[model samples]
Target: MTASTAFGQAAATGTAPAFDAARALALAQETFDIEAAAVLGLKARTGAAFARAVEAMLAVTGRVVVMGMGKSGHIGRKVAATLASTGTAAMFVHPAEASHGDLGMIKPADLVLAISNGGESDEITAILPVLKRLGAPLVAMTGNAQSTLARHADIVLDSGVAKEACPLNLAPTASTTAQLALGDALAVALLDARGFRTEDFARSHPGGALGRKLLTHLRDVMRAGGAVPRVGADTPFTELMREMSAKGLGASAVVDGEGRVLGIFTDGDLRRLVEKGRDLRGLTAREVMHPNPRGVIRDDVLAVEAAELMEKHRINSVLVIDDQGRLCGAVSSNDLMRAKVI
Candidate 1:
């Protein structure tokens, strides 16, 4: 049989042709090119309407209710998560579910963000009249500005892509990429408008490493009270050595009668003094101690700051101070390692 007849038979039987590595590689490269172009295309269309959408979401006293169908629905879920994590109150509602009593989730105080590439998702457009009745302002993210979804919207964000990355030009490839990027842009804008900081983001994600670094304070990781090795400034050098040995902190803080930190004595100092061939007897901590020691930190500062201070000065530990400048605790490099703040 001819090649055309064989090809027709293969199509009819759903039999695949031999795999072509070159064709696959070319298609993958084209996909990247198309999606990248789609995302960059958004920069031109994202102007006043984008700002208006942000303002509306900012002014909203209620959550931003996002709705979409099919692939758009998947993108909507991610958008909702990003918004929620970035300090905006938002949630995703499946368009199909809204017709099935989830419509009650939309309140008059809320602002609805609807997504559809064609501007005419039946599942979304079906509920538009009810959403309007509920008095929530609508924002449409769609490729077709003249579609039904856009017509019903109070604000229109044009996420229109030139074409899909699909070889058949039927799949939601570049379109979905554009939608995702647009959603991220909205979340970023809202976060900036609300003055969301890293600490706030960390609070929203306390289980993450960033939260441990930003939220953990010196007090949380420092050895306090009995755990700290300290002694009086006039204490004999032998007694200071004993304190450092017993506490196993590799160092000791010498304080005054008022519990103010006067100086610090460490193993390094002891070794240096030994190397100098000085008399090893009858030296007081006040004589051997290094006054105003390096790597001092406040208990209220973040643990990450303490890590920075230690790294900057090339010190192994720090003395933690209270508001009145009294020695409250100590933190070592080991402690920072255990806390994973580094």
Candidate 2:
């Protein structure tokens, strides 16, 4: 058979020759190249309209209502999530669902972001008149500048891609990648405009490790009251060892009569004493303990900061004190590891 005849047969049958490893790798590389080039082109498209879209979203007192169809809808969902997590109020509304009854989700104060590659999605364009009547500003992301959605939009963001990574140009590939990138850009720009900080992100993601690092305070994870291993400065060395062993904190705080922290003694100190063959019979806490040991205020610092302080001082534990310099609790590196702040 002729090469053209074989190609026609394959296309008609919706099948192609089996791909070997080298061909598969080459195709994957080509796909990445197409998508990367498409993303690079977006840098020049970020102009006045992009800035206007950000301003419009920021100006709205209500949430951003994102609408799209099919693959664009999937990207819109992610965009909405990113915006909401980054301190912007946003939610995705399916165009078909909006036509049914979800249009109620859009308020007069809300801003609408509609995505359609061709700028002619019937489901999305059909609602433009309604959005206009509701006094909601419309921002359209599309490749076609003169399409219906673009023409009716208050702000037009050109997300045009030169080609699709799909060999047949039938599937949404590079176009969707461009849309996703533009959505991320919008979310990040709004994040910067609002001066969103890491703590703000942590607040939004309290279940994650970063949130634990930022929001967990020393008081929350410290051993307090009776659980803290502490002894008076005049306590005998045998009593101090018993307290340290019972508490299992690997260290004991040596404080004065009023419970003000004076120093600390750890297993390392015991090792040094043993190596010197010092007599424990007459030793006191004041003689064996480290003077003016490092400590942190119980409620004044985060657990992560306490961990950093431990690392800085090369110590395994720290005494927690109150504002008036009274010893209140103690925290160890184990506590930080358990809290997932280490």
Candidate 3:
């Protein structure tokens, strides 16, 4: 590239005056070290106050009203979300907004979780009395134990850090990291106290992968009724192959007159038989099928469990049975993939 072109590119991107790769790497490592130490420091100072905060939140009949300002506000939002998803009802309310009208979001039965690094964010301090008067319990997470926010709080969690990762030490780096780690610790404790389970977490995150795995049932994703490729024990091998091809399930279940599963035959089985020069034309499904296939599942089974069964048995498809052991449906690895359950 020409000098003018390079200058133009640099000007367009608002490039810095100098680039020092080694210095940048060193500073990056220092930043990680500082932030990691800050979080570790919080672990050391955490005590009964943290337990009291979790107990207060667990006892709350109403949602946790998380209040903070600036960068603390961002951390508050994440904390609120984590709490809500993990069985604790919580929401973030910006301090400045609360001073105007959002204070109504808090109730007497609710709990307030106030976050401020210096413990004296003007927006937070300005409303401490109002929060107190509202009759809601308050838990403060702050770096300064003697600050106004901490002084007014019912429980104080010390998230203090010695220094920030910033070279100038003006930016909210280590302090904010400490606050975030403290918030996560609080959420984890509350969830454990509440007996929150994986299924409960999945309910709050139905759109995510874990939710799909836990919530999706075999019946929800299985090809049922006529969609299932099935044939009788007396069915000719050609007719069974036709059923498999027509349903495109890659396998066919051999059921009795009562619809109970007796055997299963797959394309793989047919291939092996063909390679063995076995005359399939005179064969019946019962004669050629693998009886009591191990990859059989119930309709009530979780889709993830079905995936596990298929993986464990090295099968591409599974036959689904009802409570009476009757063939109800079938599911393939491709079906699971389409449902995003695998």
Q: Score candidate 2 by lDDT.
A: 0.90
Name model 2 segments beyond 4 Å from true. 1-16, 295-298
Error of 3 at 72 (Å): 0.6
- Which regions in candidate 3 have their CA more than 4 angstroms from the true location? 1-17
Tens digits of per-residue lDDT for model 1 on 64-134?
Answer: 99988999999999999999999999999999989999998889999999989998998998999999999
Q: Give the per-residue Cα lDDT of candidate 2 at 245.
A: 99
> Candidate 1: lDDT of 313?
91
Alpha-carbon error at 107 in model 2, in Å? 1.9
- Expressed as tens digits, the lDDT of each residue in 211-272 for candidate 3 is 99999999999999899999999999889889989999889999999999999999899899
- Output the better candidate (2/3) by lDDT: 3
Better of 2 and 3 by TM-score: 3
**What would the per-residue lDDT of candidate 2 be over residues 1-342, giving only the tens digit for each residue?**
533344446678998777457655665777899899999999998899999999999999999999899999999999999999999999999999898999998999999999999989989988889999999999999988999999999999999999888766678999999999999999999999999998899999999888999899888999999999999999998999999999999999998888888899999999999999989878899999999876555657888888888889888888899888898899889888998898
Candidates' C-alpha lDDT: 0.91, 0.90, 0.90
Q: Estimate each model's TM-score.
A: 0.87, 0.91, 0.93
